[model samples]
Target: MRADARKNHDHLLAVAGTAIAEQGVDVSLRDVARRADVGLATLLRHFPTREALLDALLRTRFDELTARAGELETSSPSEDALVSWLRDCVACAHEYRGVTALMAAALEDAESALHASCVAMRAAGARLLTRAQAAGTARTDIDGTDLFALVAALAWLSDQTSLAPRADHLFDVVAGAILTSAGNSATGTTAPRPRP
Candidate 1:
């Protein structure tokens, strides 16, 4: 890609990502083109179809998160590291609200975002979980898949409720379930923490 073409491509990707994140994957390509200050022909030239656009959108974000997780992969306390990464993931979740759904929809079109995103997130998450488990901070029984499932579920749930402060509580209640029995024993209760 030439410098000018590369700039246009990057602009389109940014606009498309913002549009999809704000409105959803269902947002039309015209809107993306408008936001990018490009013509529909240009948009289509870069992204042949809706699936192509969404795949690129998701792949960009997945790659970003993978890089972030890699940079943060240190020998820190497992629980702390896991918590840090989860916070980062939550931020990403908020940044791209319907990203999970977009990827799901993309798969129905036989797109590659699903596999690529899954592989990237899985590898990053595995490293975090392994460190957490090693530090005896996370439950040994829970693996990367379990944690990712919990995070995805929580991300979906969080997106549903726009209750601001309540979002953190919602995530904790759902994610806390996987903590070891001795983990939150100090709290002296297995019941769901009452919502704020």
Candidate 2:
């Protein structure tokens, strides 16, 4: 890319990140272009599609989660690291109102521009998950895919206005299910009890 083109790309990404953070991921592409003082054609040239734009915008956060998982492997206990990473994934998914949907779709579509990033993110979680399971702390039957689904579900549930306030509690419930230790088992005393 030319110097001017690279400048525009950087400007657009900066502006779009701010826009999405304030407005939402669904903010118009044209709005992003206008905000960046670039043309729609230019934005399209750089991002191609909404998902591509989102993928770029969220790339840093995704990479951070991946890196955190690796750090956690050495810094925290096996089960603690896995649950902590799952919480981080949920937080990332909820960064934008609609990010979880985009992530969920990207996970299944290899053609998606975000697919590679999504795969990397899951692989990081898988490493932590495998460590936990090997330690007999997490369920052995579940894999990274299941972890992704659980994160997605947590993200979605966190978005529901009616249930949003209790989402953290729900996350703890599910996390307990994922654990298989003496006290942390799904039916154990640490599990969240259902409301009458």
Candidate 3:
């Protein structure tokens, strides 16, 4: 690509990242083009589709998380790494409205634009989970899929306005369940319930 065209592409990505962060992945492509001072045709020329753009945006984060997992393998205890990375996954999903749903669908669809990224993320979390289980810090019965489901559920809860005040506590309670000490006890728990 020519220097000028490369500049335009970078500018579009920067603008789109901000727009998506502020307005969500569902934000208008036209608005992104306008904010980037580029034409719709230019945006399409660069990204082709909304999924393509989201894939680009998510790739860096996924790579970072994967790298972090590798670092934590050497730097932290197995259980600590697993729990910290799970929280990170929830935060990443919460960055965009409706992304938890997107992630859940992407995980099972190998052909989806987000599939490879999701797979990498799951693998990273799986490494931590396996380590934790082997160390007897986390339940051996739970696998990476269960951890992913828990993070996605937490991210979904984060999107609910009614859960604002109690989200943190609920996260603690849910995330704690992976620990062997949580012991399947519901006694004295005040965790919020799903709306019917």
Winner by TM-score: 3
lDDT tens digits by residue: candidate 3, 50-113 = 9988888787777788888888889987767776787778888777777777888888899998
- lDDT (CA) for every model shown? 0.68, 0.84, 0.79
Which ranges of candidate 1 are over 4 A from the true structure? 104-111, 162-164, 174-176, 179-196
Q: Residue-wise lDDT of candidate 1 within 1-196, one digit each (tens)?
A: 8999889888898888788778876789998998888889999999999878877777767777777777677644555556667766766666677766554444345446457675767679778878766655556776776766666666776677566558777666644554444334422335432222
User: Of the pair 1 and 3, which is ahead by lDDT?
Assistant: 3
Clash-forming residue pairs, model 3: none
Off by over 4 Å in 2: 1-8, 21-24, 37-42, 182-196
Q: Rank candidates, lDDT, best first.
A: 2, 3, 1
The root-mean-square deviation over C-alpha atoms between each candidate and the true structure, in angstroms, is: 4.9, 4.3, 5.3
Worst 10 residues of 1 by lDDT: 186-195
Tens digit of per-residue lDDT, candidate 2, span 20-131: 7667679999999999897899999999998788887787788899999999999988888888899999988876667877787888899987788889999999999999
lDDT of 3 at 67: 87
How far residue 140's Cα lies from its native spot in candidate 3, in Å, is 1.7
TM-score of each: 0.79, 0.82, 0.86
Predicted structure 2, TM vs. truth: 0.82
